[model samples]
Target: MAALLGPVITPEGPLTGQLAGDPFHPDTKHAAKALAQVVEALLRAVIGWLYRLALLWVMVDIVSFPHDDRPAALT
Candidate 1:
Protein backbone atom coordinates (compact mmCIF):
# COMPACT_ATOMS: atom_id res chain seq x y z
CA MET A 1 0.00 0.00 0.00
CA ALA A 2 1.14 3.59 -0.73
CA ALA A 3 0.70 6.10 2.04
CA LEU A 4 1.00 9.88 1.65
CA LEU A 5 3.06 11.57 4.35
CA GLY A 6 2.40 15.16 5.38
CA PRO A 7 4.57 17.67 3.51
CA VAL A 8 8.13 17.15 4.65
CA ILE A 9 9.79 19.32 1.98
CA THR A 10 9.14 20.71 -1.52
CA PRO A 11 9.97 23.67 -3.79
CA GLU A 12 6.59 25.21 -2.90
CA GLY A 13 6.26 24.94 0.90
CA PRO A 14 5.23 21.24 0.89
CA LEU A 15 3.48 18.74 -1.35
CA THR A 16 1.87 15.32 -0.86
CA GLY A 17 2.68 12.20 -2.86
CA GLN A 18 3.01 8.44 -2.60
CA LEU A 19 5.33 7.62 0.30
CA ALA A 20 5.86 3.90 0.02
CA GLY A 21 4.31 0.83 -1.58
CA ASP A 22 5.27 -2.68 -2.60
CA PRO A 23 7.66 -2.44 -5.53
CA PHE A 24 6.55 -5.76 -6.94
CA HIS A 25 2.81 -5.71 -6.12
CA PRO A 26 0.69 -2.80 -4.93
CA ASP A 27 -2.43 -3.05 -2.76
CA THR A 28 -5.84 -1.95 -4.03
CA LYS A 29 -7.23 -1.08 -0.58
CA HIS A 30 -5.91 2.49 -0.68
CA ALA A 31 -7.29 3.04 -4.19
CA ALA A 32 -10.67 1.80 -3.06
CA LYS A 33 -10.62 4.13 -0.07
CA ALA A 34 -9.85 7.15 -2.29
CA LEU A 35 -12.62 6.20 -4.71
CA ALA A 36 -15.17 5.83 -1.90
CA GLN A 37 -14.26 9.24 -0.52
CA VAL A 38 -14.80 10.92 -3.90
CA VAL A 39 -18.12 9.11 -4.39
CA GLU A 40 -19.35 10.07 -0.92
CA ALA A 41 -18.59 13.73 -1.59
CA LEU A 42 -20.47 13.64 -4.90
CA LEU A 43 -23.49 11.95 -3.32
CA ARG A 44 -23.57 14.53 -0.54
CA ALA A 45 -23.70 17.39 -3.05
CA VAL A 46 -26.52 15.73 -5.03
CA ILE A 47 -28.55 15.03 -1.91
CA GLY A 48 -28.14 18.61 -0.77
CA TRP A 49 -29.44 19.89 -4.13
CA LEU A 50 -32.45 17.56 -3.95
CA TYR A 51 -33.23 18.75 -0.44
CA ARG A 52 -33.14 22.39 -1.56
CA LEU A 53 -35.38 21.62 -4.52
CA ALA A 54 -37.95 19.99 -2.25
CA LEU A 55 -37.86 22.92 0.15
CA LEU A 56 -38.37 25.42 -2.68
CA TRP A 57 -41.42 23.49 -3.87
CA VAL A 58 -42.91 23.79 -0.39
CA MET A 59 -42.13 27.50 -0.10
CA VAL A 60 -43.65 28.49 -3.46
CA ASP A 61 -47.45 28.63 -3.50
CA ILE A 62 -49.60 27.48 -6.43
CA VAL A 63 -53.23 28.44 -7.17
CA SER A 64 -55.58 26.51 -9.48
CA PHE A 65 -58.10 28.13 -11.83
CA PRO A 66 -61.90 27.54 -11.50
CA HIS A 67 -61.46 26.32 -7.93
CA ASP A 68 -59.53 29.34 -6.63
CA ASP A 69 -60.84 31.93 -9.08
CA ARG A 70 -62.65 35.05 -7.81
CA PRO A 71 -66.31 35.76 -8.67
CA ALA A 72 -67.40 38.97 -10.43
CA ALA A 73 -67.95 41.98 -8.11
CA LEU A 74 -71.53 43.09 -7.44
CA THR A 75 -72.72 46.19 -9.30
Candidate 2:
Protein backbone atom coordinates (compact mmCIF):
# COMPACT_ATOMS: atom_id res chain seq x y z
CA MET A 1 0.00 0.00 0.00
CA ALA A 2 2.76 2.44 0.93
CA ALA A 3 4.69 1.59 -2.19
CA LEU A 4 1.70 2.44 -4.30
CA LEU A 5 0.79 5.63 -2.41
CA GLY A 6 4.27 6.96 -1.75
CA PRO A 7 6.30 10.00 -2.93
CA VAL A 8 3.93 12.84 -2.18
CA ILE A 9 3.61 14.97 -5.23
CA THR A 10 3.63 18.75 -4.85
CA PRO A 11 1.23 20.75 -6.88
CA GLU A 12 2.39 23.80 -8.82
CA GLY A 13 0.81 26.22 -6.40
CA PRO A 14 1.75 28.87 -3.85
CA LEU A 15 3.00 26.62 -1.00
CA THR A 16 5.20 24.50 -3.22
CA GLY A 17 8.70 25.33 -1.98
CA GLN A 18 7.91 26.17 1.63
CA LEU A 19 5.56 23.35 2.40
CA ALA A 20 7.32 20.56 0.48
CA GLY A 21 10.91 21.26 1.32
CA ASP A 22 13.30 18.31 0.99
CA PRO A 23 16.85 19.00 2.04
CA PHE A 24 18.16 15.88 0.34
CA HIS A 25 15.75 16.28 -2.54
CA PRO A 26 14.90 12.64 -2.08
CA ASP A 27 11.42 12.97 -0.64
CA THR A 28 9.00 15.66 0.41
CA LYS A 29 7.87 15.96 4.02
CA HIS A 30 4.59 14.33 3.13
CA ALA A 31 6.38 11.46 1.46
CA ALA A 32 8.67 11.16 4.42
CA LYS A 33 5.68 10.95 6.68
CA ALA A 34 4.25 8.18 4.54
CA LEU A 35 7.57 6.35 4.59
CA ALA A 36 7.74 6.68 8.36
CA GLN A 37 4.25 5.30 8.66
CA VAL A 38 5.21 2.37 6.47
CA VAL A 39 8.25 1.68 8.61
CA GLU A 40 6.12 1.73 11.75
CA ALA A 41 3.68 -0.72 10.19
CA LEU A 42 6.51 -3.03 9.21
CA LEU A 43 7.82 -3.00 12.73
CA ARG A 44 4.42 -3.85 14.11
CA ALA A 45 4.04 -6.74 11.69
CA VAL A 46 7.43 -8.14 12.63
CA ILE A 47 6.61 -7.97 16.32
CA GLY A 48 3.26 -9.66 15.78
CA TRP A 49 4.86 -12.46 13.80
CA LEU A 50 7.44 -12.97 16.50
CA TYR A 51 4.75 -13.27 19.16
CA ARG A 52 2.84 -15.84 17.11
CA LEU A 53 6.00 -17.86 16.54
CA ALA A 54 6.71 -17.90 20.26
CA LEU A 55 3.23 -19.15 21.02
CA LEU A 56 3.55 -21.88 18.41
CA TRP A 57 6.85 -23.00 19.87
CA VAL A 58 5.35 -23.20 23.33
CA MET A 59 2.43 -25.32 22.10
CA VAL A 60 4.78 -27.62 20.22
CA ASP A 61 6.93 -28.12 23.29
CA ILE A 62 3.92 -28.92 25.44
CA VAL A 63 2.54 -31.44 22.98
CA SER A 64 5.87 -33.17 22.28
CA PHE A 65 6.11 -34.54 25.84
CA PRO A 66 7.06 -38.17 26.42
CA HIS A 67 3.60 -39.68 26.95
CA ASP A 68 4.84 -43.07 28.08
CA ASP A 69 3.26 -45.31 30.75
CA ARG A 70 5.89 -44.13 33.19
CA PRO A 71 5.22 -41.03 35.23
CA ALA A 72 7.04 -37.82 35.94
CA ALA A 73 9.70 -37.50 38.61
CA LEU A 74 8.45 -37.41 42.17
CA THR A 75 11.05 -35.09 43.58
What are the root-mean-square deviations of the candidates from the true structure over C-alphas? 9.6, 8.8
TM-score of 1: 0.47
Candidate 1: stretches off by over 4 Å: 1-26, 62-75
Give me the overall lDDT of model 1: 0.62
TM-score of each: 0.47, 0.55
lDDT (C-alpha) at residue 67 in model 1:
52
Each candidate's lDDT (Cα)? 0.62, 0.71
Model 2, residue 55: distance off in Å is 0.4
lDDT of 1 by residue, 6-34 (tens): 45564444433443233332334667677
Q: Report model 2's TM-score to 2 decimal places.
A: 0.55
lDDT of 2 by residue, 1-75 (tens): 534665546464333444446455445656778889999999999999999999999999989976675556742
Q: Which residues of candidate 2, in runs, are more than 4 Å off? A: 1-21, 24-27, 67-75
